[model samples]
Target: MEAALSRLEARVLVYVMEHVPAAVGGRAVEIALDPDGPPAVFASAPLAPSPGAAVVFTLGRSGRRVVATLTDADPVIVGALLARVERAAPAGDPVRILPLAEPALVDAGRAGVALLPPSAGRWFPDLPDAIRFDAALVQVSMAVFLSPQELADAQAHGPAALLGAFGRGERDLIRFGARPR
Candidate 1:
């Protein structure tokens, strides 16, 4: 696979590995950076087992980038990380680092995001509410790249749902694989 991650990206990956479970895969980490006020947004994809494969989604001020990593043949560790990744993402709209792994179906047409099964649905749901929920708390394995808007979004979602959606997105990416540019 190609090496697209920077030093910061790699650090974030390591953090996730250390904290999250192995089953989780396709982890996405989003960060928001703002000079004043709360962050704009923070989000991540779901996590799933990739065994030797891992897809990292990095969000920055400019836009979004993705890096794919293939670890040594160790499915168990991969699975563990995947789980932890799911637990670590943030939710709601706030200035913070939101790690989203699995990406529900992205409707370019509509600014909507949702969490669906592996390949059950075509369109995923958008962020439902803008309130942070305690029950929706998830752990943040690590963070590499972030932007202002992303941080604000995290504050909005809180933490619980952020992690959950991240885990789901990670799994979906692994299953669907990356698309050609």
Candidate 2:
């Protein structure tokens, strides 16, 4: 029998597919995150300009679907990283960097994530509540892998500050194991 998606699952899939560029050849891939963990489907697509870089976002609604844009597009490496996020998602702030025990894909092991609010010319969060999804559209967070020192900097100053450093340096935020400095 064919499996059907729940309402929330459908919404999460639509949201990610709509926001992620189609030019990257993004497509959903189903994978078992763990033997006992919940099932997950993640969208994977290559990022242009940066060779080997790719973006992957979950289609699951557990603790809100997560998006990871990394330098290594390998599913194994990305799955390992996502597994870490899945384990940590329910514990604290939904948007922040979490430390990874080992190097993820690239040289960096630290990972940072932030919610991506809806925007159309203007940020939807600034609009009236009725203008948006009643309970907020399927929430999604962008995850970026970072160096240990970079994670420390984000924890010290703030995620925004670390992101600013990337912007100022013209660094590719999706680059896995990237150290903005």
Best by lDDT: 2
lDDT of each: 0.31, 0.51
Off by over 4 Å in 2: 1-4, 48-52, 90-94, 102-136, 166-169, 177-181
Q: After superposition, how far is residue 86 of candidate 1 from its true place, in Å?
A: 16
Model 2: lDDT of residue 94: 42
Cα deviation in Å at residue 118, candidate 1?
Answer: 21
**TM-scores of all models?**
0.25, 0.66
- Candidate 1 local lDDT, residue 93: 27
> In model 2, what lDDT does residue 142 have?
51
Per-residue alpha-carbon lDDT of candidate 1 for residues 1-181, written as tens digits (9 for 90 to 100): 2235544445544543443333443443332233553222122324334344443322221222211222332323333333333333333222234334323212111121222221121122221112122332221222212233433455576544545645555323233223335
Tens-place lDDT per residue, model 2, 109-150, is 444543322221121222221112457443445565666677
Kindly provide the TM-score of model 2 when superposed on the true structure, using C-alpha atoms.
0.66
